[model samples]
Target chain A: MPQRQGSLDQAPTGVPLTIVRLDESDLSLKLMEMGCLPGEKLEILHRASGGDPLAIKVMEYVLGLRAREAAAVWVSWGDTPLRNLWNSQEP
Target chain B: MSLQRIFLAGNPNSGKSTLFNALTGLHHKTANFPGVTVESLQTEIELRSTGKVVLVDLPGTYSLYPQSQDEWVACQALVQAASEGIPTVVVVVVDASNLNRSLLLIHQIQELGLSMQVVLNKCDRVANPGLKGVVQWFENEMKIKALVCDARKGQGLNEVSKAFGQRLAEARSGAVSTVPGPWAASWNEVFGQGLETQNLGNEVIRAQHSAETVERYRRINQSLKTCPLHETKAKAALPNGPDRLLLHPVGGILVFVAVMALMFQALFAWASYPMDFIENMMLWAGENLRQFLEPRYPAMSHLVTKGLMPGIGGVLVFVPQIFLLFLFLVLLEESGYMARVSYLMDRNLKRIGLNGKSIVPMLGGFACAVPAIAATRNIVSWKERLSTIMILPLMSCSARLPVYALLIQFAVPEGYILGIFSLQGLTMMGLYLMGVVAAVLSALVMKFWIREKGPSYFMLEIPAYQWPVSRNLWQVPLRYCLSFVQGAGKVIVVVSLLLWFLASFGPDHKMSETLTGQATPPVLEKSYAGVLGKALEPVIMPLGFDWKIGIALVTSFAAREVFVGTMATIYGLEGDPNQDGTQLRLKERMQKDTVGGSKEPLFNRATVWSLLVFYAFALQCMSTVAATKQETRSWKWPLIQLLYLSALAYLASLAVYQWSL
Candidate 1:
């Protein structure tokens, strides 16, 4: 099945999503280097009270990014379960 | 053998600094990289076989491709060391649990062709197979030795040290060229070519670099597959239960407030005993020095006892409080909780035109603003960083602690509210909160005024929490205390001497006039500093300050805490001479000091509160202004910072004095 493409901020919390591509922005390179490259699996773990900076688990680490930066990171909803994403190695 | 220099490089949060501390113990010096505030720590390590070697710990960076100024510093140091023909061995520290990703940097460093070793630090966090296989892969495929070390536990460090020694011996014995002159030249050639191609514009080059990095990671993953490792299963989820609650929207804010309240309470209560001890010790020393010297060398004794003693004592008395403040801060940082603070503060800070990362520097500003302003380098946007630096000094640093302690004694009653909170302690906390509020308000003003055109992003990695190492707990605080003394001590002493000279000698009359015993002018009023203070008195009079306070306000621009020592010196010099060799306590002297015509004490409630308000809002630290200039690379920001904060201080003090009266 074709997957829906949207920003990581729009991705459902606690669900796994695969990063499609990080848009060409100043932060994209840093985000990519921080293990947010295309094909990497990440899940939004928590959103702060103001709902701008969200915590996402990626590369076996929890990272915090604001909604503006997260919007630059385009992701596709993953078909695999969050449990499977946890068990599988980086493809 | 000549000492070989080894560079330790790693990604941030990769246990690199922990390893450096473990290796060097107490024998290291931290200095800034040339022209940059990023600290480069170099230490001499004596290996059993290889005599002495210098280990340079570079600031952490993710890649050779520079992102921030900090990363650029690391990259430049690496490239410069390679080019300088230094007998250098590059040691790349990688997080063991995150081997595949860590290899990306190793690959970049390897291309530099310098003698290199890979340390898979934090090995204890990963499973045994993962650690062993990575080591084996590095030794066999990459032809580089890799050691699995738990820097926290000091595991596998001996092997690292021994391997380093062996590598140095081989290089010295002409078996290999550690400097790799030809390899460096070739790498530079490629780098130069890349720069030439950068006419493609920054976006294109950045995209190219990102694609290249992604490709490199893919290759690293492919290579890791051949190692004898089991399928990596995310083990025992990141001990994130505490984070969940700590990062909770409502709960997190409450916890942050509670943590800050506890921190302030500890600063006041826990530091009081040490402060009192220091104060008493200073008094005792002064009494003994005066007794010992008055009969022997009266003039010399006065210089030592009255001038130097009070100056040095003022700086020393705050050491305990400064140490405690840093101890708590270092503990928070080493435990990985500080990142959470950034996360928690990000949303609120965003409203005031700062990112989450600004919180680190803001919290750090509480200890001191010099380093705190330097710490703003990590904030990506120029606008956010500038605002953070501009407002940082408003956070009451430990330098202001002595001032507050002295003034709060007079301003607030010793009574307690609800049978628990000391009014004095509450007032201290209120002053700190007032600083924070003023800082936030000023930043809000700066946000609109200073127009920076660029996107500001906040991305922070919340590392898994670890128990802070005990040695590190003390080392960090000790380093801060030492640097504080070194940085602020010299200025305090020099200013003290200048003040002493000013307050001791009046306009030089000839020897005949002194011999004729013409009634000498009051030394303080006729002295240079007193004259200057009196000259400025008309401005400060509205805030209830006499010329004595005016003198302190002028001298304290060197540092906030100098106000205490300045007062001590002024009072020590002006006090009655035949008081049985006992100096009046500064607090008592201030309390007894009455305005010329009025019976009211000089440091009454209105004046004391006004002074507190003034200090709370003023940018009094010269070092902070210098740091702001260095960090912002502009005189404009620091000048604007000084002018606005002074205005705020004046207005605030005026309002407070009027309201209290």
Candidate 2:
């Protein structure tokens, strides 16, 4: 089956999505430095009441990201359940 | 012996400060980096072998490449120290459980070619077997010493101190530079060889930073694979249980409201007793001093009893309220809850060109603007920080509470609203609400004109909530109060003395004549303050204020609460004061006093409302102006604030007076 893909902002909450790429260079750098690397598995934990800043768990830490910044991050769900790289043993 | 300097750097929420404080104890001095408001804390640590070394806590940053003010300060301090050839050892504090991500920063610092050591903080939250492997990996692959520490628990801190001692000893012996890893070679290949200062555009620099981060992460992941580690075995340290309720869309906001309500309840209910005690103590001391000095030296007696005593009393009286407010502020901040608050309020505040962090200072503004302005340093965006400072004085502060009380009592009659709430109480509430509304509207207006310094971002880390450290609970508030008393307190004293001088003496001969003719208090018409008031009367006439209220307004520049005292002195000098120091007598005198030429009452509904509205909006506190200048590092913002708020006050009061008439 073809993998599902969208911006991290539109990804369903509680489902582990693998980061494909970040759209903006500045944000991509910050996100990557913060351990949101491509192929890293993350899940949207909570959306703030106004639905702009979403809390996402990645690299065993939760980070608050604005939806605009989140939109720059593209993520996808693969056919196989990808283990959290920072958590599980590396392949 | 020359003091060896060790710089501690880390990402935010890495518990770097906790480690620094634990290492240095309570002996550190916080100093601002030469020109900026970003505070740097340093203390002399007596290492077991090195004797004396200065441990400086650099502001937390995710990368050496800077974004925010604090981050820039950290970056500059590190690079500047390196360029200046200071014998410095950079100690990178890393969150042990998040070792892979933490290695990225470690790589950046090492790539800077600075001698570095790693202190894995929050190791208590990590499994022992995995933590051991991580330490071995750092010592071997990175060729840097690593020590495990639970900084919060003050565990294994001795090992950290010893590691720093060895690093600094090595540096002092002319053995400098961190062990150059393969990644450093690759980084040099990518971004030129040496760490020379480069003048690059922001876009190009950020793009470079992006490239560097990706490469570093890849290297970090590669390094992690070679190391034996079971990070999944680490117990989950996330505070999911409390965060569920605290970060809930509706429940979180309601919890915030409850928290604020409880804080205010503590502020008003508990702080009032100490305030009253301070007031009465000052009055008693003044009365006794006056009795002793009145006969021997009348002029000295007047100066000491009337001028200095009240001036000092005015400043000290607010200490209790300030202390209480800071206590609550420190508690909220030290606990991880403050981060959640910013997260909740981020979207709404963004509309008005403010960050979620702006909420901390805005809330603090209710207690006092001096500290509130200082609190804006944490706001990343310059536009949001500046706008927050500008609107801070608009929040009805504790000083204005007394002014509101005095005016509301004089104007609004004692009656129940809907047979439940007091009309006078409701009026006070309305005035407070008016301030909040004005501040919001002002910020909305400010967003259009205040240019952004850089692109704003709201990326924040909500750290796991924990019981606040007992020592910081009291120390933080104490430090704030001490700074307030030292900085703003002096301004209050000087302004009060100046007001006293202005109110007591005239241009020439008039003061003695009025004093000898009347009682001890000089006649209001003859004093320099009275002359100034008469000069100002025409300007304020549209707001239904006469020369006497004008004198009060002039004195009120010292503080808004000074208006009540000024009015009492004015009425006492002109009217009867048989029953001295009774507010009732002052009230009756103000009630009976007429307009200069007419039989109409001086303080009718229109005049009272006008005065109340005027006081609500005016920038009456010199301390607030001084704070704004200090925080902004310029006089331009403070001057603009004064002019803008004064104009707003004048127009608002004019409207209120005219509409009420």
Candidate 3:
């Protein structure tokens, strides 16, 4: 399916997105190590009161990243057909 | 043969510590590695077949590339062990449920060419088919031996120990290679090429590294598919449902407030009885010792009962509250609620150049800043970590509770607010809130004014919520309590005795008159401490404090809670109506006291409030200074902390005193 690339923080809550690329930053390595690799699907679970730190589920774990940090993660906005690709792979 | 040292390493929250404790039982000692403050646990275990080996549990790390100070320490220890000709075996504990992520670190360790064994911890959480496949992948594909064990339940531990014992025997017999293997060649190829490139940030180099990481994940995923591990049973969905309400904007805030309120209430109300019991025990011992020794050696007995016992008691009395605070903190961490707290607090904290992780240490500061500053290792950004450490001392710790209680009793009138709440309770709350405000403002100043050039990043994993392990819940708090007694106990005792001596002996100016028992000024007035206080009188006079209060202030630097003990000793020495010293409470003595040569009370409104304000802002505890030095790895920051906080305390106390007058 065709999709539009956007910052992860811009994606609406509850919608799934596939991480396409992470911008070069100190957090890029850490994010990648946390299973946020390119082509991995994730969903925004919830947002805090001020909508700055968003909780996202990836690789069967929830991770919290502020919007500025989330901005570095470029993700494709679309409903992933293989929604449970990462979760299904979990042992 | 000499004893072999085994290094245990793993990712954070991978149950490495649990495994270490299970293997070592209670035969373990936690000590800082060399000069660093990062704790390493060492234990001796005598295996049936392998004799005895010393197991050193290194700090948890995500990878060989260090991210935080703790990880750096772990990496350094591992490298040092390898470089030195130590007969060492490295055991990497991996999370069975998250094998791929855990394998990242395992792969790095393998490249280091150490004889390694992998313990697949938390096997109970994984399906049997998945567990079999993981074991097969490790044994067949990676050419590494693996043991499946549930460290939490102590399952498969015997097999693990046997495997380790067998491997240790093999390594000792020179059957296994302890030098760099073929994997080291590939490691050099990957990282060496990246370093040799002139354009470090070139897209080509980044793409190459990304491709390498992606290839590793692909291999891991492909290996998992080789076995018939199905997703028939759904993962437990319990925490998610409750998280909906707990993480809601309004509900979350309300719940956080309620949780904190409950914690503080327990620290104050529940801990009070134990504190009182400790106090009474100290008093009883002091009185008995005095009675037994006063006849033959009055001066020696006075020092023992009045000086040594009270000083040690003052330090021990705080143990109960500190234990309770850590009890709640450990429960929160083990249950995984602490991660959620960081998530919730991140947005607000980011404005002050901090993230959610800083909130844990700040909240911890309210209990004590020593451990709180140690907690800052979780903050990845250097700037945020420094600012957080600098502002942590402003939080009112449990040590301030006694001083505040004494002052509020004398300064604030006993009244009811709205005929429902006690005015004194409200005043106490206001003082706590004032410290928080001061901390926040100071952090803001640091964020805007302090020039720190570094990329700010915040990312944290919110682990799945689980039932708090009863063993861990108790063990952690117990360890912290023991650490407090061991670490801060010596400082408090020595300071207490020195204070006692200074308050007891004076200059020999009237030697002949004293021998004849002629009338002279009170002994305390001519004592070393009294003279020191009188010398500082001109400096503190503007804050409405007299020489005696000045003396207490100087002694209180050993620990803030010592302020109460210092006051009690001075007033007891002054000899009021209850000259026996056991009858008068500290508050009673303080209330009856009057300014010298004046009818006015010494603890007037202006003076009491000024003192409260001073203590609230001052960095009065020596232990906190020592901890700050250890954490920052320099004396400069702690020295600056002392000067800045002292200046702030002085000016703030001056304003409050002037206004109240």
Per-candidate DockQ values are 0.54, 0.56, 0.48
The collision pairs in model 1 are none
Better of 2 and 3 by TM-score: 3
Backbone collision tally, model 2: 0
For B1-661, candidate 2 gives per-residue lDDT tens digits of 4567999998877888777767765564652211112456777878888787888888787876665656766777776665556678999998776777778778778766667889888776555633777778877888888888887778888888888888887777767655554444433332342322222125655666677778778877887787765454432223357777888878888999778766655655567689779778876887788789978878777767666776666666667876777677667866778888998889988998788878777877776777678767656667888899999998888777657655676688878757855676567657766887898888988899776555567887766666666665565556555665665557656665676677777675456654454445445677787888999989999999999899888777877767756665555446354457432334567788788868988888899999999988999988799889987778999999999899999999999999999
lDDT of 2: 0.73
**Model 3 chain B lowest lDDT segment of ten:** B193-202
Which candidate has the highest DockQ of all? 2
Per-candidate local distance difference test: 0.78, 0.73, 0.74
Better candidate by DockQ, 1 or 2: 2
> What are the chain B TM-scores of all models?
0.91, 0.80, 0.87
Q: Report the lDDT tens digits of candidate 3 across residue range B1-661.
A: 4578788899777778778767875454762211112467787898888788888888888765555666766766766565566667788998666676777777667667667899988666655623776677677877788888888877888998898887787666656654343344443343344322122334554555555566666766776566444332335332366677677777877898778767766765577789889878877877788889878776567667667776677677778887787778767776777778888888778888776888878877877787678878767777788889999999998789778867988788888767855667667777877898999888998888667555566787776666766666666666666766776677666776787767766775453443234534246788888899999999999999999999989888988888877786776566555756464555777888888868899999999999999999999998889988988778988998899899999999999999999
Question: How many residue pairs collide in each prediction?
Answer: 0, 0, 0
- Measured by TM-score, the strongest candidate is 1
Highest lDDT scorer: 1
Q: Write candidate 1's Cα lDDT for B303-329 as tens digits.
A: 777688899889998898888888777
lDDT of 3 at B77: 72
Ranking of models by DockQ: 2, 1, 3
